[model samples]
Target: MEKNLRLRKNEDYKKVYSRGFRFYNKDFNGLCLDSKNNGPRVGFTITKKYGKANMRNRTRRRLKEIVRLNRDILPNLDIIIVPKKHTYTMDFNSLNDSYLNLIYFMNKRYKRK
Candidate 1:
């Protein structure tokens, strides 16, 4: 993902976590807030509880790839993804499905606001 398309600053992540609405499945939790930006921007967090640095990095990479491929599904939002222990073991297709399901739920919830 490009620099502009990522929520890179500590303040940015803090703002999203503090103000965004949240959603989750068995393996991941997502927080999203509306943004004035023309496109969606994303951030990822995987705690030490998940594993060592390499394992966390791998999970982050997987999440980033899923977002990159499905960017069009969400726009004008800032999102943060926090993966659970199971996320490290889930297959790509299952992970993608979980993500899409969360997005769909988010969309529905947003529309009601």
Candidate 2:
């Protein structure tokens, strides 16, 4: 992912978590808020309970790639993706589908400009 398209600040994550609209399914959870930037910015979060550092890093990488591939269609928003334990063992295609589904619903529900 590009540096400008990533949510890196602690305050940014906290603001999204505290105030953003949330969506989720069996695979992952997402929080999104209106962005001040020109394009969508994304962040991946995996807790210690999810797994060790290596496992969490792997899951983060997969999610990042999924977002990177579809970044152009995304809205101008700040999004935080929280992957569940199920994501670690899930196939790439399935994970991509899950992400797309989440984004589809989010777009339908939040009519942001």
Candidate 3:
């Protein structure tokens, strides 16, 4: 994703983690806070407990790709996607579907307020 559209700072992640509205599915959880910048920004976090570096990187890549493809439709918010353990073994198509579902859920829930 583009640098301007990424949540890169430690404080940014912490703000989302501590105060953002949350949405979730069996595959992952999303934390979203209204954006303070010109557009939406996203970040991904996969704990070391999930796997070795390679596996974590692969999962991060999958999530990032999904977001990149759908960036135009995303609302103007700051989002952090945290994947569950199940994602490690899941196929990309299924993972994509799950991530989209979670985004749909976020849109519905976040927009009501």
Candidate lDDT scores, in order, read 0.84, 0.89, 0.89
Q: Tens digit of lDDT per residue, candidate 2, span 1-113?
A: 89988999999999999989999878889899999888889998899999899999989898889989988778788998899897899999999999998888788888665
What candidate 1 gets wrong by more than 4 Å, as runs, is 111-113
Candidate with top TM-score is 2
Name the weakest run of 10 consecutive residues (lDDT summed) in model 1: 104-113
**How close is every model to the real structure, measured as TM-score?**
0.91, 0.95, 0.94
- Position 60, candidate 3: lDDT: 88
Question: Tell me, what's the RMSD of every candidate?
Answer: 1.5, 1.3, 1.2
lDDT of 3 by residue, 21-79 (tens): 98889999899998899999999989999989999999988888888898988889999
Model 2: runs farther than 4 Å from truth? Answer: none
Task: Return the clash pairs for model 1, or none.
Answer: none
The alpha-carbon lDDT assigned to residue 51 of candidate 3 equals: 87
